[model samples]
Target: MSASVPTVGSWHRLDRAGLQAVIDVLWLVGHRVVGPQVADGAIVIRDLRGVAELPTGWLDDQDGGSYRLRHDPVAGTFDHVVGPHSLKNFLFPARETIASFVQLNGSWSQTPPPAQVPPLAVLGVRGCDLAALAIQDRVFLGSGYVDEPYKSRREKLFLVAVNCRRAAATCFCHSMGSGPAAGPGFDLALTEIEGGFACEVGSERGAAVLAEAVAAGASIGGCSPEEVEAARGVPQALAARMHARQQGDGEPRPRSLDTHGIRDLLMTNLEHPRWDEVAARCLSCTNCTLVCPTCFCSSVQEVADLSGDHVDRERQWASCFSLDHARMHGHSVRSSTAARYRQWLTHKFAGWIDQFDTSGCTGCGRCITWCPVGIDVTEEIAAIRASGSGAAPPDGAAPAGAPEAGETAS
Candidate 1:
């Protein structure tokens, strides 16, 4: 095998054995490789020891509050859509101690997180999740205040994007304009075709990795023009199907979010009755916020040993749905469930744009599929739009016409 660094943007075809060589190459390069695999009856991102660990011949059928797996011998390894877990779980981990302080012998000590973290190579990254990474970049990196931990993990992340061949029922990336195809920010973007995968080298790192794979005996061959076009069509066809279905073009119920004036739509309709209606079904369980790719609400707490000698300050994922999310002086600002729900939705669609110049939601359908009660955000937004604006409820603290145009979060 000729070991050479594929130029950025080069196209090549990798057969099944060659694909495994790519994984082997990453492992040899000291990366902890992770990919999608069947676990607990769902396709979740997990550590991959080899290509066999991939969810081959397995397909996931996802819907509002429902996720099931099926086996298809002809299905590609990455045909399944996203599960509840995402890169957010790895990059911005569910919980971590940003800074820890210890006291003993009338002295105080401060310890920072370890700077050395193992590099990780993530495979089967859907375009929607890739878009989400950008959104988070704006928050943790682009934002004036940098979140060091998030940046550390993100910097070490090597993304392997997959051109989606199918979308789950709840998918609305077409409406959000986030996916159905891999965008920028990947090392290698793969399109699974008849005999193997067509790979596009996206970065210098990716090129170098391909070089290593070739040196390790991977079969990297140039793809013909027709084969490249066939590879490209995989994502294009999916996008077209979603677009047509979202337009109600002779299809059954379709999930979509209309973003035209979406900010003004939600900001002006705060007092709409849909809030109360959805809240009745809302479990306040934090499932939506947990699954959402860009929801960055967090909380910090201090831990002290019983001996009163050691203490640690930790931060964990938090949600606006929590009763104490906006608590100040032991009083919750959003005391009612309706108020909490309003805060999350408005922040995701409206306030986020104001803060980050982009909508927080990537329309990955994670929130909809993971919700126990199947309360779809797209449906709620449509209902609110249909109802126009409602008169402020009797117990409402804010006025109706201009009820909290922007949101304040912890």
Candidate 2:
């Protein structure tokens, strides 16, 4: 239970009983248990009650931004690929109230979400999701302003990050250098082994939780050194597999983009033709931002129950793609779809680095995979880069290496 990096510490066979025991320990300590479970025909994170709820043998088949659920008929166990949803939902909910207002006599009273956060144990969180968590932390709990609700809850959660043994076709975390193994931002890291599991305590809180489990008859037998080695190998092997799947023909060399000048690119390319091309294919449903792990833009709205006696204010997820998102002073800054798409991609890959000292994308590929038309971000960027110049000049302006409109490298 000590916070020592054990070459050989406690090893518990991670079977149904062992998993259930850990869950029980987490719950006993007032930690809410959340993990992957079969829902809506796909693996999704939900409130987990027991080991029976975990999707054991379910794997997923994904391609070009499409996903499907299928039985792992051969393994007889479902260790499915990561689903559309990430662990962000529980931490930064889709719909949350920052403050609420109510009418009391002739005055309006305001209330806010509780400052204190409940203990949470997020089980089966993938490496990509973990990376996403780190990015969100920068946005919500970073330097400029700390989001009260997010900051409070983030401090209380216990993360049990899982290595992705099976790579999803839609995943691009490796490109963004976020995953395939548990690095930082986790209290406990888990790797599922053949018979048992290899548990690595990542923090003092993790050690305490493991100690409680060990005390509760969670035996540390049958987890030999070889099992630990094997479990460790799985993550590395998975990483290689993920690397192989990344588009762009092998990994791009570690060359730093001049992110300092990226905002200029965004500002200059306002009238670039690529925006129109993307708009033609985009449904503008706002799915990309909704599933995006780092898109933190939100809007506040007031709701009144049918009784009309009370008004409750709520903060809901907002997307730049929404016309309402950019409305100001009876006019919208970006009413065109071309402008909307440009705003999103440029900020994510470029300006975000200035705003938060990190890239907005961890390359989880959720936005690409979840997009109805299969718009690949990598492909879009490649096209933009291949266009020669960042943007074309207006009217009779001379070409500054900008490609002709509708021209793309085949």
> Please, what is the whole-model Cα lDDT of each candidate in the order they appear?
0.84, 0.70
lDDT (tens digit, per residue) of candidate 1 on 1-410: 22234878888889879889999889888999999989999888888978888888998887778888999988888888999899998888888878877776799998766566788999999888988999899999997999988887788889889999998889988777778888889999999988889998999999899888988888798777787788899899999988877767432256877666667778888888888999999999999999888888889888778987767778889999998799999999999899999999999988887888788888899999899998899889877766676423323454332223212111
Off by over 4 Å in 1: 1-5, 248-252, 305-307, 389-410
* Candidate topping TM-score: 1
TM-score per prediction, in order, is 0.92, 0.84
Candidate 1 global lDDT: 0.84
- Clashes found in each candidate (C-alpha, N, C closer than 3 A): 0, 8
lDDT of 2 by residue, 188-295 (tens): 777877664677667778767776776787764445577767777987987776655542453221111222233445556666678899899988889999888778
Task: List where candidate 2 sits over 4 angstroms from the true fold.
Answer: 1-13, 74-78, 112-117, 222-226, 245-271, 305-309, 390-410
